[model samples]
Target: MQAVLNAISDPTRRAALALLQGGEECCVCELMTRLNASQSRMSRHMKMLQDAGLVIGRRDAKWVRYRRNRDLAPEFAAVIDAVLAAERPLEEDMA
Candidate 1:
């Protein structure tokens, strides 16, 4: 889907996806800190991923926590897995 592809096209969103890939629910504040992003920027990135059905979020009081959508269609899951796999080396290279 175009939305899914578009969501993953942004490096920031891809990094966010990598964080969520661990299967733990991550809070927006944590993402903000980890990614060195502002609250509004992280929210927009999360919204994009959520709109693509790549992630699901729940309200935790004043914050939203997110995780990868466990029920993704097989095709989308495949794409996400491949992207995350590909991203690992790039991250390591940067580090």
Candidate 2:
């Protein structure tokens, strides 16, 4: 879909989703630290992914944790897999 492609066209956003492909939740802080990004910037990127329906977020205390959306068309899942496969190894999660 155009939305998915638009959301993922940015490398940073793609990397964020790739990190989440493992089916585990990660805090916004964790993603910020791992990606070497600031809070506002990471938040904006997360919003884009959320808009695309690729991920979901939950608020816990002072943090927001995000995880991949479980419901997806098979085609979208394949696209995610393809991106993960094409991208290089991810940086360690430093948060």
Best by TM-score: 1
Poorest lDDT segment (10 consecutive residues) of candidate 1: 83-92
Instruction: Flag regions of model 2 displaced more than 4 Å.
Output: 89-95
Q: Supply the global lDDT for candidate 1.
A: 0.94
Over the full model, what C-alpha lDDT does candidate 2 score relative to the true structure?
Answer: 0.88
Error of 2 at 13 (Å): 0.7
lDDT for each candidate structure = 0.94, 0.88
lDDT string, candidate 2, 1-95, tens digits: 99999998998898899889999898878999999999999999999999899999989998889999999788998998887776654433433
Clashing pairs in 1: none
Q: Estimate, for each residue in 1-95, the C-alpha lDDT of model 1 and write its tens digit.
A: 99999999998999999988989899989999999999999999999999999999999999899999999999999999998898889889989
Model 1 regions lying over 4 Å from their true place: none
- How far off is residue 34 in model 2, in Å? 0.4
